[model samples]
Target chain A: MTLTINDFADLRSAEALEAALRAIGAERYHSNHPFHHLLHSGQLDKGQVQAWALNRWYYQSRIPMKDAAFMSRVVDPDLRREWSQRVVDHDGTREGVGGVTKWLRLCTGLGLDEAYVRSEQGILPATKFAVEAYVHYVRERSLLQAVASSLTELFSPTIIKDRVAGMLKHYDFVDEATLGYFQARITQAPRDSDFALAFVKQHARNEEERQQVCEALLFKCDVLWAQLDALHHAYVLEGGIPPGAFEPVREQGRVAA
Target chain B: MTLTINDFADLRSAEALEAALRAIGAERYHSNHPFHHLLHSGQLDKGQVQAWALNRWYYQSRIPMKDAAFMSRVVDPDLRREWSQRVVDHDGTREGVGGVTKWLRLCTGLGLDEAYVRSEQGILPATKFAVEAYVHYVRERSLLQAVASSLTELFSPTIIKDRVAGMLKHYDFVDEATLGYFQARITQAPRDSDFALAFVKQHARNEEERQQVCEALLFKCDVLWAQLDALHHAYVLEGGIPPGAFEPVREQGRVAA
Candidate 1:
């Protein structure tokens, strides 16, 4: 079902609006995807997990681009000031640090080559499409919608906790330092999503505006969900790999046809 | 593998560059995808066909937007003048005419709701991402690369002929009238692609520019191939439909889990 702006026609209060937005994450977030189930439950093999980390690095690398796109359109100094931190968080104050670098550490920790992950040649075509869509959505949509899209971060903390604990417990290759990206995001995401959620609630004052916010969150969920769907389809399911996507150097169990 | 500008270091002549671009198509085009084989070989059921038509309508509907984006970035009046015709062709001189309208007719002819198809809610997330990537590539890339991306049309005439002929021969529900979109494209695509090919060959004069052109065309082929990959993975291979994509009202063969 496609989400339309008219779906939240009756939502007027800020609390009600907040509830609607949270409801979208509850129902549509990538955490609900079966791939997440596989990842968090340690049901996937090392190569499959390698594929996950490798594909996810693309999304991680693009977060700053998405934020930059969002920031380029914002005129308010305060909003820009608040939002610029996200760019720093991902890109870092200098090279060899920040979230993207940390993600590279996780990828390398998984026994994948750093250059291969950075080149992003082996990632599924669907992963590229989905990540690019998020950047475009932020660039093209209304400020309310753009801010609301980041509300996916509002739900990320729980997933991060679950993921960190699950991966540490289940996977021998992943260690505390390797998962630094998620460890940082557990704090960073709440701080970012809190600001974004407050901004969305304050800005989206009417029914139509509220609906746009809800739909924006839904769209963001779709972005995240679609990425996992691609990963699961390509790496996990039988005979699911597309031509030209990343092939693991060592096939753990499921072999590419 | 990630296609880089360095990949075309040996190709200096337009003829060589053209061969390289066409080689990418021969190897990577959606015509080579399994979904197209199923589509053209009359292997899929009506509901599956409906899913194909409905999802494709999103792509068909976005052509004008993509063209308009390209035209918007063109400061050259002559270039814009030549390019604007594509928008006219897809959007039509009148409301009930044009390629998008004809695609709607094709959808309705395939038993899909016109409004629903137009809403584009049912398109796979991968489809949206791939199509939007094309538009974004045109908007952000050098104008030379933008024009080169349209080179997919160079290969479209053959695919359209095979599709129209195969669908007419195999499917009882479709007639030549309902398949007017492909018939129109049989003439229109070559004309558009010829102009685009000439523009790319003439503008991409040096080795670096030639490499960019090749990468651009390869990128466009990836865009097309990726969409089919999504459809095949979701609808044909393993019933791995992402949430909120079009669900066939009747399960023709592969049942959604």
Candidate 2:
């Protein structure tokens, strides 16, 4: 989020702002993170994959709360109405099906315990921090910035496709059924990002506003990237699991990369 | 911070509470973290050491703020006055020398840029979460729990001893002058924790209170431990530095570490 006033001269138009935001996703998004490559290419073992899903469940679990936080700050009934759909999308109807539910399915598919995933007991503290920071960012920052942070969805579809297809194709334990979360996201992310992208592009009236918009996206990218960084560092690089985090139960969970 | 009602039986007495807190420290303190092992024994490289100092500066920088937060909730002027010394210890007199200033000396001695360290631009996001979570913990938890969180200071004297001695002996870049921070801490931590420990012991009225006291210390241990986890994860384990974190400058910075 390092935008200075002098560095702010070029993003005065919505076209330029859109280009800048897309450029940020292209450059800084978590898709570019190595963990994603490891994940998408089936380079990770079952434990690493389980670690990814369990930790990611924390992020997925928090999405509705982040949206609820964003909605809490909205004074306009119209904005709040539009924002409530994100909550509905994540929390689902009274049927109790949502992104978190589907994510738990994925975790179960990876051989993670559903109750344990729901309990969030074993996730890394960094995951808590990064995800909680996202909630805080929405509650504390401007409405426009809150809207802009969700713009990462603009880039999620391709990653979702790669992730779903990659998991199914490579990992024998995972089937199309387990990747239901990504399937929902495939359509949902574009619709959500279309709305958020237009909001950011339309409301960022000047260079400073545009820069703040870009910073919000950058901040969101860091949030996603940092989670993987923690996972990779703890599980892959050194296995220095913090005290009280989940230890994976090994099974037919890994796919040969 | 994972203390439940059933895990509550053992910590019933003040003696038991004190023992529990210390045991938690013995088991969970950052001193037990391998990053500290690497750091204390001179197994880390220059970049790792600089990364440690720089990232730690963020925590050191927040100490007075956390103390002031604890002080703010105090209604008893006597208690407030006793607590004010903590603020004074870190913030110092108008002479502007204190723990943070001393810590910057340590950082600068390790060849880190003083401004960059102060800017906190390169520290891990987990460091922010862990540290900010400390501040939030002080503000949001019960006053007794807030004081109990400082109980990690109970174990700090020895780590300070080991850190000072080990760094000086192992790392050529460090000397006594650079480690003024720990020298102050060597006295300050025990005094502060003595007051806090006494407060926790005297005031924890029941098994539930004692359990919470233990939980606070455990949470503080997590706070400290999580920062090192991030440092180890980013600098030592994988060098997978998160985007925008500090990159160390090479000089006569590393010993065998």
In terms of TM-score, how similar is model 2 to the real structure? 0.92
User: Candidate 1: lDDT over CA atoms?
Assistant: 0.84
The CA lDDT at A198 in model 2 is 89
Q: List the residue pairs that clash in candidate 1.
A: A1-B244, A122-A246
| TM-score on 0 to 1 scale for chain A of candidate 2 | 0.93
Q: Report, for all candidates in order, the number of backbone clashes.
A: 2, 5
lDDT of 2 by residue, A26-119 (tens): 7778898889898888898888899998899988888998888888888999989988988888878866588778888988888876666776
Query: What range of 10 consecutive residues in model 2 chain B has the weakest lDDT sum?
Result: B248-257
How displaced is residue B9 in candidate 2, in Å? Answer: 4.2
Shift in Å, residue B225, candidate 1: 1.6
**DockQ per candidate, 2 decimals:** 0.41, 0.43
Native-vs-model 2 lDDT?
0.82
**How many times do residue backbones clash in model 1?**
2
